[model samples]
Target: MIINKFGFRSNVKSVSLSVMDCSAGMLSISLFKDLLKVHKNSVALVLSMEVVTPNGYNGKVKSMHMANILFRMGGAAILLSNRKQDKHKAKYKLQNLVRTRLGSDDQAYQSVHQQPDEAGKVGVSLSQELLHVAAKALRTNISELSPLVLPYSEQLQHGWSVIKQKIWFLAGQKGTYVPSFKKAFEHFCTHAGGKAVIDAIEDNLRLHKEDAEASRMTLYRFGKTSSSSLWYGLSYLEAKGRVKKGDRVWKIAFGSGFMCNSAVWKCITNLDPNLRNSWSDRIHLYPVEIPEVCDH
Candidate 1:
């Protein structure tokens, strides 16, 4: 609609969807894929930013305190194009997008919320159980992504692993082997929502120190930029010259409403130095020592 502000016609086709918090960005990617399927040569722009104005919640709740510390002030816009000629200029090509939700579960539904208090106070509320809920959502999301990105042999191994795990569970035993996602992606760009969230993903996915470097550095330098956090991670990797042609990058985000969403992209070319973002000047200093409480 803003195109009309520049004198463009309002007759352009549109499809809009609203998703929960950080998950909204990846959800946009999902919808954009649908739009591309319907129209051959269209492009979609997804803009995401954190809301820091009209500051909500001045209370002493721990979640509010954490939110104030984690959510920073920033935004990013991503362009998705399906045009053949555009490929030469595009940085990455869309691979796939997967979204998973835990709305049916009561605990998951109440994990992160905005509600009116009995006294009529309204502010975002986050539960202590959020990590637990997020872990569940993250697992579900990765499960969906496995089929799309995993190699044929990896998928077969995963299938057998699942069956073996089921048998172990039936025998009142536990299966410790979880498929390694490292082989599926060259770089991982996860939401820098919190140190705990990143740590949980690293542990769950069996990722090593370098695997989560981009995300950790993003949080250290930018705090948590909400939906744009994934982009920040990607930027960090880019600025560090870690991305290359044909490499696969995976972005995963966790948001309120216990949602987890993922988007995968394949690099079209080596990152151009001139195209590096704001982090260019400070990239070398990052992955800095982020202490437990680096209150800014």
Candidate 2:
């Protein structure tokens, strides 16, 4: 249909994927980078979408129940290319992408899975243990990501902080120091899955409220939006003009297969406020106080 509408040749090579729900979006971009790297000057179009139907679930399990409340309708198409000519119009350039999967572990793979119970009823059961699995994956991913994105000075400081914490640990001290990601990134587009997920990231990263305001506002306005929440948060920042040339934004997400995927992008040009986005009409209404519970 895209080719029919856009008048592209019918025989263009294309690939489609299904990579563990929320991870699908970032994984597609990861594949895009590899394709562009090998094919020289080629362009790749990555499309992500999720369809939620009530008929799919009839169980009252925690995960299945939450899914209806969290995930909303979303779809997005991203164009990526290695051609130098396309750089001028690009909003951001990919810097680093890290994908981690804990599928090897039974707990991780089973944390959020569709399974049948005693009466032959199937539902996606979410274990509280899911948080532990996700947090572990997050730490491993960030441990590798920090050095690539953090400035030299910040890296040195973080290293020394780690050394001190280790020394304190050996001295029977009950403490741990987590490096601040804000020192490395100007903006963060955390997956707007839920308030708890956002809060866990903020706490672990040692970020200030101003740093998390975009994510909080994104969650408030858009709910989960699945993997596309990253763009929603980015749009919130772009809508408020927080993103500018040379700024770095991090996109982080977690998926059902107990996957943690992250990508860092450097803004090449200022985001135009007038450019088309979902927040055009009510951006001013955002960065507002989002209550914990919605009362109907």
Candidate 3:
């Protein structure tokens, strides 16, 4: 949870994405995206993350072990600016994104479920089918966002094919089609849900190992911080001084309800490498490849 410390509680409406899955990272970023667009020229402070142990299930042996190995406490705070005048100082531009929710099946939502057992110990269980749900949701979201961002040539060819087949219904009416995301954004911050989730997305998006390094590192360093993981991923880029003015970045996260949320952002300032945070501080102790999982 991120909050403004301006000494006025009433002025701030604490926005929280609780119990959100890995995709919450994207959802929170999308919220910031909307806020920036509405307030144009102002800065929006975004805080996101999750504390999963409080809801852990103790009786379920397999589930509890999985949770123990997969989750860690982590969060992040990011400042976003949308002012066009700030372009000179801006680090990146808000690009295009597509969000989609597939609640057609209750099972998909239940794939990664949280509940209590007979012993009253709460825990989360990830069904073997959860990955399938994620893949389906991602496919739907990409199909919707691809046409809009794809190059004109690719769009024309794909558009004509869809039109000829009366398959416009497949992409929907919003024109969500986008060309390869590589053409529109310089960096990618995928939610650090877990190794499997990250691997799945990397394969699906055709992202290079370097493109996913930030996310993987954050997950290894800080574990799954839920909605805030995406910001941590971005911070990795900033920490390395990789983000430059006018660069475009894309953030993607997954969450309950089997939803895929995305946000596109352009940097407004050169991030300070010396910036400090509870999360980043811990990164120093982490191994570059994979770190041991410790209970917090």
TM-score for all predictions?
0.89, 0.90, 0.76
Highest TM-score against the true fold, candidate: 2
Give per-model CA RMSD: 2.6, 2.5, 5.8
Error of 2 at 288 (Å): 1.6
Instruction: Estimate candidate 2's alpha-carbon lDDT, on a 0 to 1 scale.
Output: 0.79
lDDT per residue (tens digit) for residues 106-176 in model 1: 99999997765555656677888999999999889877888889888878877776677678455554654
Off by over 4 Å in 3: 1-6, 9-11, 32-43, 80-93, 156-179, 270-296
Question: Candidate 2, after superposition: displacement of residue 278 in Å?
Answer: 0.7
Q: How do all the candidates rank in terms of lDDT, highest first?
A: 1, 2, 3
Task: Provide the global lDDT of candidate 3 against the true structure.
Answer: 0.71
Over 4 Å off, model 1: 1-8, 13-19, 58-66, 168-174, 293-296
Q: Per-residue alpha-carbon lDDT of model 2 for 1-296, expressed as tens digits?
A: 56767787667766767535778889888988887888997888877766666425666555566556556777777888899999998999999999888888999998888777656666567888987888998988888887888778877876776677678456564454566677778998887777788888888888788888887877777666677778778888888988999999999999877889999999998778887788889987877876659511
Worst 10 residues of 1 by lDDT: 168-177
Please list the C-alpha lDDT of all candidates, in the order they appear.
0.80, 0.79, 0.71
